[model samples]
Target: MATFATSDQLLVIIDPAARQTDGESVRIAKDVLSAGAAAKLCLPEGPEEFARALDRRGSRRPVVIGDGRALVRAVTLLHRQRELAGCALSVVPVGDTALAESLGVPGGAVAAARAVLDGAERRLDLLVDDSDGVVLGALGIPPAPGRAVAARPVPIASGRPWYRSLVRTLASRPARLPAVPSPCAARLRVEVDGRTVVDLDQPVVTVSVTPGTDGVASVEVRPLSVGAEATPLLASGRSVTVTGADFRYRADAAVSGPVRRRTWRVAEGAWGLVLPAGR
Candidate 1:
């Protein structure tokens, strides 16, 4: 909804990750977009150039061609500049497009490019943190950052390091670490809309926050059970807060924080995306 009316002018930003991951797909997307509209392509080598290209987009609508992280990168920049509410983004997911797919974008280059040229604007909700970070998809605790390994420290009754636990990696796939703090579970206080759902006294297993379709964030906190398996504490609210020991979390596909406290609030219908008209 950035522009009052749809125009043929388009700003196509092809991400470097897409080129590196799948060059053939990128080429196909480029061919389709250029043939459909009056497009100005920006092939940025890095993040800075990418931000610059999008920031300088005048009246032309932005069409991002890349993976989930690239899409998040675009949204994050627009949100930071307070332009997300006004701009409607068109996405062509090239590699690992789980986030883009969840938001209703048609997968693959041809389908997505077609959507960009002939589609309707669909507005959606998002979560923004105190530090101005945004989460477009589901967020998970016990953060998994890289393609390698991850370790998060948990405080035990006695001050000592927890034993290291590793998962085996096969082929070119990366090993996924255990999500919870094993042996010594992490103690965290989770609050949903000012009400404390899980306090620091109890050790936590994991937590997740996802933007619900009903304009609120769905929160789930799994705590360590003493006798029986503990049912995950669930709540829905416009705001959520977590405090206690420092913890890292995965927002969309990125890792964030070693912070003691963080708060996230829902911004309902905050951004718009162009999707297939019938979809």
Candidate 2:
């Protein structure tokens, strides 16, 4: 069921990381793509160059060659430019293909390149945050002391009440502070579509939110030590908000923030991906 595409219609972007880590794979992908179509190839050494390459891309479809992080970076750039909806991206995952595999992208270099030349475009949902950040796949708050735990406190601006600012100043003035406390479960206030699913008093073990094809995000919250019979709170909605003491979360392959609050909502069919026709 795959449709054919000419090289003139393709733009191949090879992430520098992929080239450094696996030159063979990058070469193989390039070879396949070159043989299949008369595509233009871009080898961006860093983020700025990557952006420039995309900006220079005329009417050709972009095919990213790298791992999951590269894919996320490309999508984020397109999203920021407000041109994501008009572009149909294809990815040839290089190193550590876990995230790409989850997104249904082929793992091998040659196979993925071939798919790019003969594939169907499928629009996919995205999670957009209040800060304009984009998440291509699932977002999760892992267990405390895990990857989400902040190593050090990040300074916040003094727009708060005078008393609160005074306390923050006093707390940082201590020459010798007490030992840092061991990590414990987070007390989060999780809301879905304006309804509270978990309150601040509840100790949360973990939380996960994934956008579905139906344009809704499925949210699941697990309570800390809720006993063997306890079940996770699950719901589906367009928006999900989590608030608590400073915490971080993993979105796709990246970890973002030691923020006190974050909200994500589904932007249905916000972007498109090229996949094998029958897939």
Candidate 3:
């Protein structure tokens, strides 16, 4: 799948979170993009409209101007529609730009806006799970020996950052999410390409997997040692499977699952992202 647009006809979707986080940056990006391209701007109030914008975007290039979660939401929506690789997606990162920055999008809105109008498409690898979920960056499994704290409204105490309001809404929800995994040792089984690197007998401190070069994932499993900490087990493979008794994992910016088992496979060049040319 590949995008057909080369010139600057754009569908600029400004996610609401970005508008809430930093309106000035959003305005600046909008100005730059409007000045440079034939832009159709969409100021969606929420996720449903944000998604609909993409579904209706004909041949116009989609340039997302928002925070990390918005970027993930855009990609996730397109991917679910099976159009991820078919379109070249650009982003003008606003708040929490780490994931976009890592993929070569500039951190500054103005610069990112310029790149969106004049960038080359770069096909990137992303992890796809059996449950049709994706991890855009790294994935981790941390140990937790105890149950989660009773669910309640974590008071929006003073001095919490603006971004935390979004986080607070998510964290303080009625449904109990898996508690943030503790640092304690957890019994888990991790396998890379069918070889078991970590067995249930061994307690693990953490396990990490990231998309690496040449269509494989770089996997690292660190075991918990009683004395004189043990070395981490490392391997790379096209597929990884993790199993344990109800565990949670940190995938990119969110924590997911108390699943008994999950499997992820590398989808080689399965999605395309727009990046500054010569990057």
- Please name the candidate that would achieve the greatest TM-score relative to the true structure: 2
Per-candidate Cα lDDT values, in order, are 0.86, 0.85, 0.85
The candidate scoring highest on lDDT is 1
lDDT (Cα, tens digit) per residue for candidate 1, span 1-279: 322233478999999999999999999988988888888999999999999999999989999999999999999999999899889898999999899999889888899888888888888899999999999989888674346365654433333333222221122366565576433367889999999999999998788999865689999988888888889899999999999788988899888889999999999998888988865
Report lDDT (Cα) of residue 174, candidate 3: 82
TM-score versus the correct structure, for each prediction: 0.83, 0.83, 0.83
lDDT of 2 by residue, 1-279 (tens): 225565447788999999998999999999988888878899988999999998888888888999989999989999999999888899999997998788777888888888888888888899999999888878989533544453566455566798677767767885565567543578899999999999999888789999877799999998877447348899999999999889898898888888999999999999888887877
Clashing pairs in 1: 2-86
Off by more than 4 A, model 2: 1-4, 143-184, 226-229
TM-score of 1: 0.83
RMSD list, candidates in order: 9.8, 11.3, 10.0
Better of 1 and 3 by lDDT: 1
For candidate 3, the per-residue lDDT at 267 reads: 89
